[model samples]
Target chain A: MYPNNLKYSKEHEWVDLESKKIGITHYAQESLGDVVFVELPEVGAEFEVGDSLGVVESVKAVSDVYSPVSGKVTAVNEALLDNPELINQDPYGEGWIVEMEITGGEEDLLSAEEYERLIKEE
Target chain B: MSQLKRTPLYENHVKAGAKIVDFAGFAMPVQYTGIIEEHNTVRNQAGLFDVSHMGEIEIKGKDAGKFIQKLITNNLEKIEPEKVLYSPVCYEDGGTVDDLLVYCHNWEHFWLVVNASNTEKDLDWFNKHLKDEQVTIENISDNIALLALQGPRAQEILQLLTTFDLNEIRPFRFKSIDIAGVDCLVSRTGYTGEDGFEIYLASDKACFIWETLLEKGKGYGLAPIGLGARDTLRFEAGLPLYGHELSPEITPLEAGLGFFVDLKSEHDFIGRKALEEQRAQGIPRKKVGLEMLERGIPREGYPVQKDGKEIGYITSGSPSPTLGKHLGMALIQSSEAEIGNEVEVIIRNRAVKAQIIKTPFYKKEDK
Candidate 1:
């Protein structure tokens, strides 16, 4: 399901402005197939725009999940440690990776419509 | 660029919604519904594999038997008519050229089924070494299509249509059978480490047999398995693939395939002298099975470390579905290949703890 108000990254990461929570999109999880393991960033780990946050290892290969905006990791989805399949089942909802306090301009992020076009061009 | 080859079931794989990938220069299915699902289906019931990409060579002449005996490591003299033998073709230096299945139809005629990637090279080897002999080595890879029906329930499903008494067929033996009016060579051999059959038929008739087997085997829970599950299953069984465990630089002795090499047969094969010398001196590297005590899975090409230093490398690895543990096969220095020996595998630039274990990681009960 596509969220109208959230900004999205080219790498299929979605961010909600209201809660400042970030997670992978449904399209991203679908393309990656089954999610077996997820390596999450530690709390208080600061990242700049386009920084490597963590990795998501699927059955096929490992993919590096990148940060969309500059922020510090305030909270992480620890449930992924026991149930990585949650990302495949609901990537956009409860599968959110981290809740961060946005420290940079939100204008740098692309709108959901722009991200849809970006994935279409691929 | 070399052109990609397609098997007779290429369109069929596409129609089945398979993820196509280039494997050994052939466009083949890597997965369909899912790897784990297909793998479990084959283990529990039966699965059909499109193996047309494998190379088939027909050797026919008066001295075919003697010629093959000189070329391969196995004791071909023990192989009877209508039986097959699995052996490794070695180089003059005792390094493995390829592991292949040799079928003896009679004294004057034989067939060799080799890995798909080594088709051209194997053909060249046969031609150059035959040395203007009376024997003819024809590359029949394009003309023949192969399918493997593998698992516990394979026999029950296959016996429904064929008139032949499959129960009489012993392991590693084959016979010419008529399936749906098509003449096919059905062999009681497979790579899945299961009681199964590998059926070889004319390329034109492959589709007919494939559809027929699928339809007939539906009651037996037969699924169209892809290459992904095939790899996982074979890996769990501790079977070596060509490019992985057995390479041109690695000998059969080092690869733990010495059982297939008839060293005591008193036959002078091509690599006999080199192999004898190597056997006496002891191999430099030995292939061993590794099981992770740590969390991470050691993948192929990952360096195996000992006391923070590299000693060997992992050849194949995956999470073993049967054992529910991360398992791997590695080629390590002979000095460090002892059982229960502590080792480390570099995963994501970090050395994870592992231990050397015995092979055949998952053994099946006698059916």
Candidate 2:
């Protein structure tokens, strides 16, 4: 189940509003079988919504993690540099790839309910 | 939506929670638990693979030996009955048609296991050149099923069902045996370099054998592997996959499988002239191994660069489970293929550093 507190992107990324935590959704991790490498955006890197901030490489495929809100990256989870599988273990918790300070006004990212509907419709 | 063909063991794959994907018009499992897990299982213990999607074609008659010798690059006369020979079937111009295994039963019957995607095309090519009235070719792909039990413990796991001594079957040797009352053709042959057996039987009885083998092999850590680990294992063992290392535009010499090409043999084949010309003039592009020094994983079609110029591209690459490194096989200019050369792989538009290293990232001991 998608977390209720997080804002979702159509590309299967999730963003935590209060803590500004960002990571891929559980569905995204499942679809990309066996995370082997995670390339996170460096701290202080700036990007707009829909910009490719980082990438997640799985055994089967590779996908870019798009930014959900325009922000300057404040932090990156360095643990994933050695162990990329934390994303598979906890996509919403320890798997958080980046923390950013939202710069501009927020974009109309999908709600958890809307994301669920989108997945079901797919 | 339901048009994809399913193998006889489709239900078993679904029951095991396999991730199914469309490959060669067949709904095949790409992974069961995970690629790395299944791959390490095959390296350390044992893993079973549903290779039934491979096409099996039988060439029979008095002229079978002569026709087969003309079709493939390897010398057919060197192959004995109850033995296996790996060869690359080529077009008239020296490009690969398909890399296959020829199981020679006798001068009257020869079985070839070809790539699934090339079945129809290969059959057409075979018939179009069938000038020998004494020979006949039949596509028996739909009637048979293939199972590969591979690993260090493959012999131990396979000995549970059959009364025949598995030790007598040497590498590349095969025999007819009865397993659980069903007749089967068991061979000590596998894509993985590990010691194992490849069994072929009637398609209808595939599920029963699959389930029974898994049940019997439960103690030996036999896991049902998929196409993901199959590619990784074969790649690590330096095997040339049909579509990856060998293609319509790729010759066996450039793919680093020249050992199988019998250029000096007395028999002449379809691509002999072109291959002889290549041997005399020297090969242009050749396959080489690369170990990524950077963080990115090199994938197929990623351009291999040198001094800001495109030299070649990757053919097959993965995070090797056995070696625990991001490795790749690239076909590049033969001039830069020497060991210890440095190259760059263009990953995500950024050039990542990689080092050319010795091939066969993994090989079984004394194997």
Candidate maximizing TM-score: 2
Highest-scoring model, DockQ: 2
Please give, for residues A18-45, the per-residue lDDT of candidate 1 as tens digits: 9888988888887776677787889999
Off by over 4 Å in 2: A104-107
Off by over 4 Å in 1: A1-6, A104-113, A120-122, B1-3
Question: For every model in order, what is the iRMS?
Answer: 1.7, 0.9
Docking class of 1: acceptable
Per-residue lDDT tens digits for candidate 1, residues B1-367, read: 1377899999999999998889999999988887777888888899999999999999999989888988899899879999999999999999888999999999999999999999999998888789655788999999999999999999998898789999877999999998878999999998887889999999999999999999999988998999888988888888899999998889999999988888997888888889889999988899999999987777889999999988999998887765777889999999999999999999888889999999888777895
Clashing pairs in 2: none
Local accuracy of candidate 2 as per-residue lDDT tens digits, B166-200: 99999989999998788999999998879999999
Q: How far out, in Å, is residue A60 in model 2?
A: 2.3
* C-alpha DockQ for predicted model 2: 0.84
Measured against the true structure, the TM-scores of the candidates, in listed sequence, are 0.94, 0.98
- Estimate the overall C-alpha local distance difference test score of candidate 1: 0.89
